[model samples]
Target: MSVTVERAVCATPSTQRSLLPVVGSGTQVPLVDGTSRVYANLDYAASAPALDAVAARVTEVLPLYASVHRGAGYLSQVSTALYEASRQTIARFVGARPEDVAIITRNTTDSLNLLARIVPTGPDGSPGRVLVLDLEHHANLLPWVQGSGHRTTILPIGPTVAATLQSLAAELSAWQYTLVAVTGASNVTGEGLPVADVVALAHTAGARVVVDGAQLVPHRGFSLTATDADYVAFSGHKTYAPFGAGALVGRRDWLDDGTPYLAGGGAVRDVRTDRTLWQPAPARHEAGSPNVIGAIALAEACAVLAALPDGALAAHELALRTRLVAGLEGIAGVEVLRIWPDSTEPVGVVTFTVEGHDPGLVAAYLAAEHGIGVRDGRFCAHPLLVRLGAPGGAIRASVGVGTPGEAVDRLLIALADYLTTGPLARYVVEDGCWVVADDTRPLIPVHGLDGLAATAAACGPTVEAASGSCRPRRAAHTAA
Candidate 1:
């Protein structure tokens, strides 16, 4: 199963470009030096660029969008049908059994939080104990600690992957744990874990296994039926949909028996002044108006990925990963981070650091000078980063179906240039971030609330005056 870097180096350029249709394949961006280049996006691990097919499907569904499951109009019926069909599409994509249910969520974090709410308490009416490894994203780690009727036991990873599995077996044998949450792959190192093995061990110990598949699903295929995992959670954005949807697919017994995740209109069958009766599995958890468009977009993405010729996408990514890893290893002072050195299975993610430069500065330099996008930070795995002795974090370059081999070459060339001659432009610490000196790019908002005060000021007093006078107006004409 191990493909050497030498074989990947021999792959033709055309073979790399035929991998998948990425949204921003040939997008060009201007660097700080007043030079423009086609952007090289190596930040797929954080949020992958949407697939062109997914975008097209979304556009096609927008004009017909309407309220789902609560209206009798034509568009409503269409939307409702599409939404439920999307659930089945995703369920089949994960190889869910007939009794399993797929619950639409906002993202992996929301899905895990919903599971945490439904996790049954022990005989003492207290939270049951859940086991997790140190190598988890905060999305997977934090939910178990917050409202997850479970006490979390954070286990440390051993020196090797085999040893880590052995440790998990030992821990499970020692306790009557209720559940075991693990990641299908490491977001930091891109190393695949033995998920099937983990599920077998947990099941033998009378515990259910939940996998955070946000990082794994995009790169590799999964089958809940084959693995016998109790639950799998993943984000649509990470899986090339980028439409603000996620899914939690698993066995239905616990979810059907527990209270609804959200309490609202669609979740309940009958509402009274004193008592209310909730609905069944999927509907019970989905309370308010759901994201019909996002769900359809996610389903379309799964269909497109599933339709790819067998082993085509995986082989393309492997070639790119091999080239990037081998190139990084050749550069002096570049240390590649890894949890398992002997593990050859990875998903096109590589993290590294330069000896004399900060990871943030290196990442900024790559973008400001070379127009190569990369992620620099702990990647939301703070505990794992602390254990790896990288409290400040490392630079991560992740590839996907649409990633071209030329982009990998550009990153390698940039890193070598940085190590040999230092950054082309001087960087300074600005607001706790490394930025190129005299750069003249407008600051883009990271989150919706970021720079809210400044945004309001820029809108001026006229906006405030208009807001006071604005009123909801009735529709000019009613359809039915």
Candidate 2:
């Protein structure tokens, strides 16, 4: 991976403050004189910082990084053993049997796409009728919808289980579907789903089920065995192992019957000049050089998570989520966009909009002014965001395993600042959108990543104080 994507794997503010080695030491310095900008990284739903344990393990194994499967050297054999062992770790982490296949891929999107490619086609040679909810991330929705030439039936879900089940049952009874794909949690709202019911209903229609756990796996605990999903997929980046890795854990039979997701290399058991024999399920989907480092990091992350007591993590996350939502709700001009009725149990994420400002502008201002990195836009779940009346997107503030109460407070303060002064209008005239101090820039010596450095550089001249005259100068260029 390039430095840009690799940089995303670096430590979060919480981690930086803790035992983990902060990636951008110079960047961590605050822009303001007295204030060390405590980073409120409310984008865990997109990606999470690696746990200290995961990082330590990765460090321990870095020197051991070598080609897996069939390598002549001692390190290669060790690496191969570690690689296969990591799969078992993931299987056990998700409560899967030893024989269950766990194929590592680029991310949750890649995992779902792999599953979509490998699922058996129906008697008609298509994917057959497919069932999915409107609540799905595009990763979960599109793969099944487009990959299959089959008819698709969408299930509608809202805040309540009663309403969701009614609509879901109605649709399932109507279609000759072969598969049902549901997100175990909504990335936008952080809402946990009633996946067990979904699985039960889908099976009645003779359809296998796939759970998109990209969002669910990080914040909430899950059991693949308990859910009994035919397949469970998640991104490792979201699981605090942001090394461009993810997994799709599921049964063997369906995958074994279909064509592999990719061709060549490790996917083949043996290849003749004219004819090639494919490997078994997991190996079949993993072609070319596997992401050895990524897989190691992810396995370490899962192990760390598994070691934690069950309710401790969930309780901690829920407490943060509650704090975030309550804090956001108290702010004027802030509309807490929920999954509706507001009673739904969600993870440590809350997405909403400001009455007058654009979600993108709010997110940008938060990052630029507060050193708070939150996400804005559809978050790749455009359909759901659109339905929620955020046609563009909603500002997303997600808490992670390392997130703390103080960071949430900082985010609230930033939001309050925006509500009063309005979003930084992007274009300031003489000293427009001034960055009095932006430590995330290379010139400043603190900000490390090119994306962050570029962002910091783009922000203009810094003035300790601006008079009304300077403010008026900024206002002149404002469009009607």
| Per-residue accuracy of model 1 over 107-191 as CA lDDT, tens digit each | 9989998988888877678778899999899889998887555788999998888888899999999988889999988888888
Output the TM-score of candidate 1: 0.89
Give the clash count for model 1: 0
lDDT of 2 by residue, 15-69 (tens): 1122222222233534322355656667778777777677778889889988888
lDDT scores of the candidates, listed in order: 0.83, 0.72
Which candidate leads the pack in lDDT?
A: 1
Error of 2 at 97 (Å): 2.9
Cα displacement (Å) at residue 344, model 2? 3.7
Give stretches of model 2 more than 4 Å off. Answer: 1-36, 124-126, 421-480
> Per-residue lDDT for 361 in model 1?
83
